[model samples]
Target chain A: MLSVTPQHFLILSFLLVGIGFLGLLIRRNVLLMLMSLELMLNGINVALLTFSRVGSNLDGGIFVFFIMTVAAAEVAVGLALLVALYKKRNSVLSDDMGLLKN
Target chain B: MNAVDLLFWLFAVLSVGGGLSMVFSRHPVSAAMFMIVSLVGVAALFVLLESFFLAILQVLVYAGAVMVLFLFIIMLLDVGPEAGKGKLSHFKTGIFGLLATVLLVGILLTLGNSYDSLALDQSIWPELSESKDGASHSLPFSTKVSSFGYGLMTKYMLPIQVSGFMLLAAMVGVIILSKKTPDREDLK
Candidate 1:
């Protein structure tokens, strides 16, 4: 087996995260922003598995499973909310969801 | 390169490319579909990393379940390609993109040369042949499954319970927040 290094995994994770950040910053559409969030979460999962493999603990992998479930639930709820917002405003721009006043 | 390394490189390329396309694509449904491809590649990469449990979870959760939700929303919203295209925000977003790219390249280089051995540590070194071969000290055939079951049920049960609550909370929150406003419906 060709050995996979933690650093290699780190590089991949960083790429995914950077792209996600870029997507979040540049995209006007809320749905696209959510897609970018998934990219960022997957990047974190990759880092977790890399640690799990290198550290010889099953805990990181287990944590990733939880993270995945959380992410799934988050997507479901976020989209439903997005759909509702679209009904009100006829748009899904990040700037338009002004429900929370600070 | 060994087979595992080769597979890793292949899937990594596929994932990264698919992910970029997903982000930049103008069509909402295509973006969601490309995201699924990116997810599948990540799952394949997980398998290469020797975490069988994680790989399966990735396939079933992110690729299968999450994508379905995303697709459902895209279809429901009718945010097709025509809906996605629009006027640009400002040139500042371009600057931010440039900054992000440079920072990412910097991180990649800082990690430096995957050729280094420090990347491999004692923990990851393949299980010592002696340990796996030691039949006397190792687990027996029938006990392996039961032992794993007990370990998960006992040692790492908290996460399982938390995930259930998280789902419930998210579902209720989404429902409450999305309810139609009486005024808006009356106006229509």
Candidate 2:
């Protein structure tokens, strides 16, 4: 229990992704769902940094840099869309915006 | 356990616990707050990995900027606490829950099987390599900001430019999406 290994970090990454996925599925609120997406991205970052450290490679860190860039863009677009949807529907629940379900 | 080990466990629990709570929390604001907690924990993990620059970036970018955006949206939309029950029915919830569980278990099993191969016997700390001349050669991996700067300007110059373009496009898209159109009845 005293020694921390790469496996432990990997497990944490997987757990975070798992929880984020669960949130995405069960949560009806679009905002919560987007937050879950951020959680998943963060999990991936942990794994990337772990591999970067393990292989003594700097590319993984740089890749994470790009991932963050994309994530910031994604959240901006996603929230903007959410705001638009809320304005139209007057509700944040995913079930309320099911125009294509039929 | 040593200090590193202790800190690792501490932040590990903090991150994982915060993630779990974020999923189950009723209020959007609380969930966003939990995400901040989780992000801070991940930043600590980055520090443990000896990537001081990335760790600071994680804090500044995720916990600071992204989270503020989330909070602003939550408050702007006035997202109230979810009702006592979720919108997902019992059967759909059960199916999704089982799927998530199986995925997590499968990942755990795979990692466990590969545990031996993943164990590191040598120090993972990066060391800066010395160059005979001041010319740019293949840069050795290090935790120094200079290494990152050099790598970005030399090897990753294209990607950085592309990312900038992408950000610009996303900014335009957000403005278009959120702007009130004069003729569109839906936005009104």
Candidate 3:
């Protein structure tokens, strides 16, 4: 309990991902869902860093850098889509955007 | 009981607690704030791992730029706490939550079972070797910014270029998505 190991970091990563997944499952607001997505990505980042440290591999760090780049791009595109959706529907709830459900 | 252990636990609690609060928070703005807290905590963990460069990048990109973008959107949309209250049935949400919980538990259990195999030999850290021309120069991995730069500019060059292109595409896409389409009257 006192000593920190790779396992502890891995567990933390899993917990973060789990919480994010729970949020994604339950949340209806698109923005909240996006936030949860970020949380999940962060969790993955933790795992990657841990592996990088344990193996002394720089590839993991490189992967993380790319992940961050991709994440930023995703958020930009996602939020823009969200704005367009709001403009059209006047609501950000996923339930309201189901125009094809009928 | 050691400083590393204490710091790990402190930041772990901070990050996990921030995540929980972000998920459960009633307001989108507050949720974003909590996410910033969580990102900062994760940055601290990066520092603990001795990846100072990545830690700073996490703070600058995630906690700084990405979060500001989130807040800007929140304000632009004028979203309120009411936006969070969905009309979805509780039964469906409950079922989904249960399924998610089950999946999480399964993954954690698998991880726990494989925990022994994941143990690291602290003494043996890989020292990457780069062979140029005839000479093979060995580079021991250290959490240094210079090393990251070297790797990015050399081995990971293609991926970085691809990432740059993707970012440009995203920028163009966002502009197009958010642009006001000229109505028939405006066209006339």
Candidate 1 ranges beyond 4 A from true positions: A1-3, A98-102, B82-90, B113-117, B121-125, B128-151, B179-188
Tens digit of per-residue lDDT, candidate 2, span A6-95: 888889999999999999998999999998999999999999988888776778898989999999999999999889888788999998
Residues B1-188 of candidate 2 have per-residue lDDT tens digits of 77888999999999999999999999999999999999999999999988899999999999999999999999998989988665678899889999999999999999999988887665434344554343344445578998899889998889999999999999999999988887786434
Q: Looking at candidate 2, what TM-score does chain B attain?
A: 0.90
lDDT tens per residue, model 3, B1-188: 77788999999999999999999898999999999999999999989877899999999999999999999999999888854355777899899989988988998898989877766555223344443332223233467698788888877778999999999999999998888886822542
DockQ scores of all models, one per candidate: 0.55, 0.72, 0.63
Which is the leading candidate under TM-score?
Answer: 2
**lDDT accuracy of residue A66 in candidate 3:** 93
Ranked by TM-score from best down, the candidates are 2, 3, 1
Q: What is the lDDT of residue B81 in candidate 3?
A: 87
Question: lDDT score of model 3?
Answer: 0.87
Better of 1 and 3 by DockQ: 3
Please give the lDDT score at residue A25 for candidate 1.
78
